[model samples]
Target chain A: MSFIQTLKQSVGLSTDGLTKRKTVTFGDTTAVGNGRFWSIISVITLSMAWYLGSALELVNPIFWPAPSAVWDQFINISQDGYRNFTLWEHVWASLYRILVGFALGCLIGIPLGFAMGLSEIIRGWFDPIVEFFRPIPPLAFIPLVIIWSGIGERSKILLLFFAALWIMVIAARAGVGSVKLSKIHAAYSLGATKRQILMHVILPNSLPEIFTGMRVAMGICWGTVVAAELVAAESGIGFMIMAASKFLATDIVILGVIVVGVIGYAIDILMRKLEDKLIPWKGKA
Target chain B: MSDLVVNDVSMVFDTPSGEQVHALENVSFSLKQGELLSILGPSGCGKSTLLNIIAGFLAPTDGTVELASTEIHGPGSDRGMVFQQGALFEWLSVAENIGFGLTMKGTPKDEIKKTVDHLLETVGLHDFGEKAIYELSGGMQQRVALARCLANDPDVILMDEPLGALDALTREKMQGLVLKLWKETGKTIILITHSVEEALFLGERLFVMAPRPGRIKKEYSLPFAEAGVTKDPRDVKADPDFGAKREEILNMIWEMEEEIMGQAEE
Candidate 1:
C-alpha cells in the first residue's frame, strides 16, 4: 500500500467501519457531510495503491521510490543533516525568506492599491506598470534578481516580494473598487466626512478581498520561493530536493517534496483559520 | 417646522450617443413638516431621479431643493436615506449599522448606544442588535435600514422602494411600521415606489408621475396613511377610497407604459 494509505489507517481513519452504505445519490453529490470522509478515503486509497504498485515493481523505482524507503529517508534526514543543515534549518530558511518577502509586499502594495483605487490620476499612472508586471511570472525575474543582487537570500527574497506585490496591489484595488455606491451615499447622508467614509466603510468593505488576495499571494510566494531556491539557493527544501535529485537519491527527493508540500498546506490552513476568525462576515453579506 | 420644497427641479442627462435626455422636467412639490409623500410612476419615470436630486446624490440641471429654508447643495445630516436593499453595512452588527450615523456625527458613545437601543426596540429588532446584518431576513434588513435612517433624526427622510424586496406579507407589516414610524416621529418623508397599493397606503400626499420627461401627472391627498397608523393595514387597504385611488393610479401608469412601448416600437 502507498505510505499515505498506511499513514491514514495508522491515524485511525477508515470508512469501512460505518455500518450504513453510502448510496451515491444524484444532486446530493455536492453535499459536504460524507464528502469529507470520501476525501480521506480517496487519499488513503491512493496511498495504498502506490504502496502496492511499488511493492509489485509496477513502476520504475528510479521515478517512484517505494513508500517505506522514502519514510526511511525522512527518518534519516530527521537525524543526519542533509547538506550540513538539518531539516528544520532548511524549513526555517525557506520560511524566513517567505515571511520577509510577503510582509514587504503587503506593506507597500496595499496602500499603493488603495491610492490607485481611490484616485483616477494615480490609477492611470500605475495601471500600465501593474498590468505589465502582473502577467509576468515571478520565476521569470529570478535571473534578473540573481544578476543584480547575487545568488543570495536577498535575490530570493526580492523575487518573492515582487511575486506577491502585484497580486496584493490588484487585490487591494479590487477591494476598494468593490464598495457599493449606495453604501457610500448612505454613509454621506448620515453626515460622515470623506475621511470617515474611507476609514469606516471603504476600508472594512475591502477587507474580505484583501484576505482573499493574501491567501493567493501566500500560495504564489510559496511556489515562487521553491522555484527560486531550485534555481540557486544553497540551503532550503528546494535546494535539498535539487541536490538529492542530482545524486539519484529518489527517496530523499520524495521526502523533501513531501515536506515542502506539507509546509505549504499548513500555511494555507493557518491562513484560512485566521481569515475565519478575523472576517467572520466574509461572503455572508 | 421643516418644509422640504422642490422648486421646478429638472434633470437632463447627456447620453454617450450625444443626445441630451430630459429625465425630469419641472417636478415641483412641497412637503410640510411631518408629511409623508409617495411618488409613483412606471419604470422609466424619474421618480427615483427626483428623490436622488432631493437627497443631493444627483444635481439637477435646473431648480433647487430647500429644506427648512436652507438650500441643499449636497448630502448632509439634515437628510437621511433608506435604499431598497444592500445599503446596510454587512460588516457591522445591526446595532452598529443603526448607530453609524450618530457615530459619524461624533456623538458620545453612550448616546449612540442609547439611540441605537431605542431604535432597535422601535423597529422590533432589539434582540438582533449584536447580530450581523446578513444574518437577518430581507424584511429584517429593511427594518435595520429604517432604524439606521431614523437614528440620525434628519429633517427629511428619503426612501427608495424600501420595502420592494420583501414578500407580500412582510411588506404589509413593514408598511404598517412605516406609517407608525412616520406618525410617531413626525419627520417629513419622501418615499418612491412603483407599487400602487404601497403608494395609496403610505402616502399622506401621493404624486402620480408621468414617464417621458417625467413630471407630476396627478396629486391625491389621501386619508389611508393617517388611518393606517391606528388601524390594521388590511383594513386600510379594504377602504373603498384606497381601492379607487389604487385602480386610478394603476390605470394611469399602465397607459404610460403602453405609450412608451408604442414609442419604442416606432
Candidate 2:
C-alpha cells in the first residue's frame, strides 16, 4: 500500500470506499519522481526558445544576445582574448583569488571556531566581532577593503576571505556545539581523556556541519570575488564582463555570466560529492 | 561488599526565574559488587538526575557518590553508561564503537580486536561488526550500546532506559539479554526504567521513587531476576507473586503521578 493511504487508514479515515487518486501530494514520498528528467527537459526547451527567438530577431540583439553570439564571443575571446590577457588568464585570476582567500579563511576560521565552541571565554571574546560582521554583506566591505588595501589583488582576495571567514567559523563552532551531551558523557565514562574525546567524538561529530559550512563559504566566496572584481581589479571574469558592458558587448557579458554560473554550480557539486565520500553519516544520526 | 554508595545525594536546580527546583532530595543507596538494581519512577522524579549523579556527570548539591570507597569527582572509565539511544558514535563502526574505551586507553590492537569479536558474539551481532551505526535497526543499535558499555569492564554499569526506544518484542528480548549479561559478568548494574514489569523482571532489588523532591518511596527485593537467568522470563512473570508485586508497585507509582498532576492543576 502507498504510504499516504496507509497513514490515512491508520488515522481512521475511510480508504475503503473512496476512489484512490493517483496524484502527488506535497509530503508524499512515493509520489516524488526523479526530477532530473524534468530539469533536463526544461533546460532544453528554454534554450530552443531562446535560439529560435534570437534567430528570428524577436528582440534587439543588443539587449538579449543569442546563444550562438555568446558562443562566438567565447571563441573570439579564447583566441584574441579579452583585453591583453587570454580567456584562461581571466578565469585563472578569479579562481586563484577565491582559492587563496578561501584557504586562508578555513585555516584561521576553523581553529577559531573550535576555540569558541570549546571555551566560554574564547566565545565571549570573539562572539561580538563575528556576530557584528556576519549579517553585513561582503559588498559592504568592498569599499572599506579598497580604502585599506587599495584596488589591488589584495583587496579582491581580502574581500573573498572576509566573505568566507564568518561562515566557516560559524560552521565549525556549530559542529562542536552540536555534539550530544550523552555522547560526551559516554566517552568520558568509557575512560577517554579530554583530548581523546575531542579528537574522536567531538571532531568526527562536527565534520558534517563543517562540510556544510565549507560549501556555503565557497559559494559566497565565488559571489564576493565577482563583486570585488566588479568594483575594482584589472583582470578577472567580473572585469571582463564590466569592461564589455562599457562598449555594449552584450554577447561577451552573457558569455562571462554563463561561465561564472557554470563554475559556481560545479564547485557546489564537487563539494557535495566530497561531503558524501568523507562523511557518509551526515544526517543519519 | 558494597561496591557503590550514594551518601545523602540531592540535586537542586535554580531556574532562570530565581526559583529553586528540588529535582532530588536526600536520596541514598548502596549496592553490592554484583547486584542488579532497577529504579522505577514517573517523569520528573529525578531518576535520571540521580543516575547522572551516580555516573559523576552531575554533581549533586549536597552529597557524594563513591565507587570502591573512592569518591567520584568526575566521569571515569571505572563506570560505564548505556543510554537509550544516539549515544554510539555514528562515524565509527559497531566494532570500533565497542572497542572505543580500550582504544582511548591505548590498548594493543590485537587485544582490542579479540575483545570486540568476543563482545560481538556475546551480543549476537557477530556478522555486523563492520556496519555503520545508522545502518543498524534500533534494537541492534541498543545491542551495540550494551556491548560498548561492557567492553570497558567497569565496576558498575549505569543504564538510563537502555531499551526504551525498542518495540515490545525487542524490549523483552533485550531485557532477557540484560539479565543474562548481569548474571554472567557479575557486574553491579543500576537501571532506570518506566515499565513496572521490566523493573520486576530485571531488578534483583527495585526502588520506586516519588516526584516533587524526588526520593525513594519504596524498595523491593525480588527473586524474578535470578529466576529469569535459567528459566523463561515469561514463565517467571506469570508467577502469582510477580503479578501481585507488579500491581502493588504500579499502584504506588500511579498514586504518586496522580498527586503530582493534582498539584499541578491546583
Candidate 3:
C-alpha cells in the first residue's frame, strides 16, 4: 500500500482508485446568493451619487448630461425623426455595417489563419504580407478603399472588414501555434487523420484564443463602423454625432456616443454568452 | 497479438548551427505482446527520443520500428502515448477530451459517449466527465490524460515520464495505477523515466541507457520481475537486491554523464 493511501484509509477516507471522490458545496444559500441585497444596494448608492452630482453640476452638463436628462434625450430622439432617419434607423445602419464587415472578416481571416497555423510554408508565404498590411490601421485604408471602391457601402464595409481581419489573424495564429504537440500526437495515435487532428485536436484546443479573437474582432468592428460613418454616411451614429457637432448640439452628440457605447456593450455581452455556450469548459480557463 | 520489434534504432538531431548531435545510436530492443518494459536513464539519454520514434512522432535515422510485422511509418491508434504534461485540450470537457479520437474518426456519437464513460470509469474519474481540464488538480489532470489515451484503446501504451510532474506522493500512487492498468488492459507498455526506484519497482526488465548518443548500456532483469516478486511496491523497494541494483545503475549513469559532458567540452 502507498503511504498516503494508508493514511487516508486510517481516517476513513478512500483514495483507492485513479480518482478521489469528494463532495462540494455550491451557491445555494451562501453569501454569493444575495442577489436582491446586492442589486438594491448598488441602485441606492448610484442614485444617491447621481442626485448629489446633478445638484453640484460637477461635470460638463451638455456632454456628461445627468442620467435623468440623458434618459429624457433618449425618449425624445425616439419620438423625433431627423432627416428621414430616427434613432433606430441610425442604430440599424451602424449595426448593419459592423455585422457585415465583421462577418466578412471572419470569412477571410479564420481560414487564412488556420492555413498559416497548419504549415510553415503557408506561414512563410503570408507573414510578410500580413506584417506589411497589418501595421497600417484600417482607418488608414479609408483613402485607398475610397480610391478603389469609391465612398460607398463597399468602401465602408471593406474598412470595417480590414480592421477586424488583422486582429482575428493575430488571435488565430496564437491559438493554433499554442496547441501542444503531444495533443497532436495523441490524436495521431488514435487513428485521427491530418484533417481530424486539426479540426478536433488543434482547433478545439485553441478555442479560448479563437473566442478571444471574435471578441476582439467584434470590438474592432464597432470602432471601424463608427470610423466608416465619420468618413461617408448619411445615416450612422458617427454621422449623427458629426452632424450634431456642426450645430453645437452637444446633447445630441452625447446621445450618439451613448448609443454607440450601449451597442458595443450589448454585442460584447452576446459574444461572451456565445463563447460560454460553445466552450462550456471556459469556466476552467 | 500486438508486439513491437525495434531494430538497430539510432537517432540524430542537428542544432540550428548545423552541428550533428546524436541522441540514440544502434539501440535495439523488442517487446513481446503485453510486456511492460521500463527504461531508466540519466537526463538527455534519448529515452524520450526513442519513445517518440516508436510512437511515430519522430523517425529513427538508422532503423525501423515494426508492429505485428508491419513497418511503422506514422502514428496510428495502435500506439497510444502519454506525455509527462497532461496536454488535455483546454477548451474541451473531460468527456470530450476523452472522446476526441473517436469523434475525429467519425465514430457514432452514442458509441463515443459510451466509450468515454467507460474509460472515465476505468480510470476512476466517472463523475469528472463534465469537468474541464483546469478544474482538476495535477494528479487528476494526469488521470484525465490517461483516460484520454486509454479511450483510444491502442495496442501499446508509451509513457514518457507521465508522472514526472506530480508530487512524490502522487507519483507513487500513479505508478501503482499504471501497473494495475497495464495488467488489466494487457497492453504492451514502454515507460521512460530518470528515476531508478521507479524502474526497479515497475519494470519487468529495466533498460539502462547512457547519454551522448544514448545507447542501451545495460539490461537488468530485476528480482521484482520474477513471479515470486511481491505486488507491494514497498516490499519491492525493500528487497535485498534493490539497493545493490540501484547503486550499480546509478554509477553506470554517472559515468555516462561525465563522458557526455567531457565530449561536449571538447
Candidate 4:
C-alpha cells in the first residue's frame, strides 16, 4: 500500500464502509487498536532497544550507562543518599518549592487575569508589562535573582513563581474575554446585577480557560523549578543531577533525569484529572 | 393605559472611519397590556436595535421608553428578553437556568425551586429539568429560554427572533407556544422577526419597517393573532385577508430591498 493509504488505514479513516458505522462496539476492555495498548508496546520496544544497545556496548558505558546501571543507581540513591540527602529528601524539596511557587502564582495571577479581562483600564495597565516579561525565559532571571536574594530557597521558588504567573494571567484573561456577548445580554435582561453577572456568568464560563492556563503554567513551573534548583540549591532532583554530572557519575545522572520526567508526567496527569472533574461541561457545549 | 411606550427612538452608530450608520430613526410605538406586538422588517431594518433599546441593553440617541409611567434607565428584571439563539449558560442545567433570575434576585431557595418547576412544566420540559443545556435539542433549548424568561414574571417580555434558528415545524410549534404563554400569563410581549407569517400569526399589533435609515413604514392591527387563539395557524394563514396582507407586505419589503440595492450600486 502507498504511505498515505497506510497512514489513513492506521487512523481508521481509509474505509468508506467503516465510516458509515456510526455506533461503536468494543469486543473487550483490552482492544488491540486501543491507544493504551499501543503506548505500552512502544515503551517496551524502546526499553528493549536501549537494553540491547547497552549490552552489546554499541554506546560507551561512560557516556550512556546501561539501563541496569541506572536502575542500580536509583536503588542506591534511595538507601545510601546522594550528597548527604536521600532520594526522598531531594524529591520532597523539589515538590515543596514547586507547590509554593505554583500556589502563589495562581493566587495572584487568576484575579489579575480576571481584572484584565473585565475592565479595559486594568487590561491596558497590565498588558505592556505582561507582554514585555512573558517572552523572556525564566532562566534569564537567574543572575538577578541570585544577586538580589542569594542562592537560597526564596530565589529558587521565586523563579518558578514567575514562570507560572504569566501563563496563568494570560489564560484567565483570554477565558474571560471569550465569553459570548449574548450570554451577558441574557444575564442583564434577566435582571442580574453587575456582581451577579460576574459571579454566575463570567466566572463559570471562564473556568475552562482558567483550567487550561493552569495546566500550561504547571508544566512551565515544573521545568522552571528544576532549572532554578540546578542554578543554586542544596537539595533537589536538579541538584542531584548537577552534582552527579560533575563527578562523571553517568548512571546517577540518568536516574535523576528519569525521575524528573516521571514526576512531571505524573503531575500533568493529576492536573488533567482535576480539569475533567471541575469543568465537566467544557467541550460538551 | 399602555404597558410600554417607545417615543421618537433613534440610534446613530459612528464607525471607526467617521461614518454614521442610522440603526433606528424615529421609531415610535405603544404596547397595550397583554398585547403581542410583532415588528417585521428586512435584514437591516434595526428591529433588533429597537428591541435592545426597549430591553435597556442600548441607549437610544433620542427618545424615551416608559413602562408604567416611569422612564426606562437600564436593564432590570421587569423586562425579560429571549434571544434568537437560546443564549443559555451551557454549564447550567435546564432547571438552574430557569431559576437564574430568581437566584439573582435573592429569592428563597424553596420558592425558586417551586417557580422553576412550574415553569419547566409550562414549557413542557418537566422531565428535562436536570438535563444540561447542550443535551437538549435546539427546539427544546428555546423552550427552556422561554421558561427562563417567564420565571421572572417580568411586566414585559422582549423576544428578538427567538425562533429564528428553529426548523419550519419547530418554528410553528413555538409560535403556538408564544400565543399560549401570552394568553395564560397576560404579559405584554414585543417579538421581532423577519418572517411575515410569524408576524401576522403571532402579532395582534404588527409594525412593518424599512431599512436605509431604519424606520417604521406602516402599522396594521390584524385579527389573525386573535383568530389563531382558537383556529389552527394554517387555517388562519388560509384566510383570504391573511394572503392579501402577506402579499402586500412582501411587495413592500421587496421594493425596500430594491431601493437598498440601487443605492449600494451608486
**Which candidate tops DockQ?**
2
TM-score of chain A of 4: 0.86
TM-score head-to-head 3 vs 4, winner: 4
Better of 2 and 3 by lDDT: 2
Clashing pairs in 1: A1-A51, A2-A47, A2-A48, A2-A51
Sliding window of 10 residues with minimal summed lDDT for model 3 chain B: B222-231
What is the DockQ score of candidate 2, to 2 decimals?
Answer: 0.83
Calculate DockQ per candidate and list them: 0.79, 0.83, 0.49, 0.78
Which 10-residue span in candidate 2 chain A carries the lowest summed lDDT?
A: A11-20
Ranking by DockQ: 2, 1, 4, 3
Runs with alpha carbons beyond 4 Å of true place in candidate 3: A1-71, A280-285, B108-114, B225-230, B264-266
- Specify the poorest-scoring 10-residue window by lDDT in model 3 chain A: A25-34
* Per-residue C-alpha lDDT of model 4 across residues B30-85, encoded as one tens digit per residue: 88889999999988889888888888889999999999988998898889999888
Q: Chain B TM-score for each model?
A: 0.98, 0.98, 0.93, 0.97
Tens-digit lDDT string for candidate 1 (A1-285): 779887666655544533336566356543324445567778999999999999999999899999999988877777887998888888888999999999999999999999999999999999999999999999999999999999899998899899989999999999999999999999999999999998999999999999999999999999899888898989998999999999999988889898989999999999999999989988887
Runs off by more than 4 Å, candidate 1: A1-41, A52-63
> Positional deviation of B183 in candidate 1, in angstroms?
1.1
Give the alpha carbon lDDT tens digit for every residue of A178-204 in model 4: 898889999998889899889999999
For candidate 3, write residues A1-285 as lDDT tens digits: 689877655544553343333243354233223255456668799988876787689877765567777677678778795556788988888888888888888888888888898889999999998898787867778888889898777878888888888777877888898887877777788788887777777787778887899998888778877877877777888888888778777777777887898889999999999998888776464
Give Cα distance to truth, residue A253, candidate 3, Å.
1.1
